[model samples]
Target: MDSDSHPAAAPADDKTWEELVKNVLRAEMMRRGVSYAALAERLAAFGITDNELNLRNKVSRGRFTAVFLMQVLKALEVEWVHVPASIDDAARKGGAQALAASKRQP
Candidate 1:
């Protein structure tokens, strides 16, 4: 994915980490113009058979494992991923705020 298309970086803190991972995958999908069906098809070639509905649910929850992440990345042809050694204070503060706001909801 192009660097410009990335959402502002944030720390995958205790609460917001799942969302961060989910957004990263979703952004990559969006960048490749990959639909759930297309992803399902690609995975099928590797003997994985997650249907569109399952894939959608999995991506939305963002609670999948590292193996799942790799499978999706491989299927999507992601060459590499970056990991920030540290997140800046502003981004961490924003992530914390977002996580708190989410928990206070009905």
Candidate 2:
């Protein structure tokens, strides 16, 4: 109810995007009753080789590449992901910030 509690002022940083992506993937997995081992097997059907432990680590870190995200979604047979516009905007901003930061790190 208070302005300080609003997410609009949240920092659009890597951590925000990481948490968002992690939550989305985990929620999807829960929705479909899919475990890490089961997900690994499903990915194998599509020629993606990943063990349950690796999958767990990746999802836990929430720092995987977009290609990996697509692979997992495809393996899950997910047609689409429904992200709120505000969240999507924030994630995009976060991505841009990350890219900019990487560019400056050299």
In candidate 2, stretches whose alpha carbon ends up further than 4 angstroms from where it belongs are 1-10, 85-106
Q: Give one digit per residue, the lDDT tens place, for model 1 in 3-96.
A: 6686556655644666656666775676678988999999999899999999999987879999999999999998865432333431343433
Q: Pairing residues by index, what is the TM-score of model 2?
A: 0.70
For model 2, residues 2-98, the per-residue Cα lDDT tens digits are: 8666554554577877866876777667657889999999999998899999999998788999999999988888786755335544255344233
TM-score of each: 0.66, 0.70
What shift in Å separates residue 18 of candidate 2 from its native position after superposition? 0.4
Clashes of each: 0, 0
Highest TM-score scorer = 2
Model 1's number of clashes is 0
Model 1 TM-score on a 0 to 1 scale: 0.66
Candidate 1: worst 10 consecutive residues by lDDT? 97-106
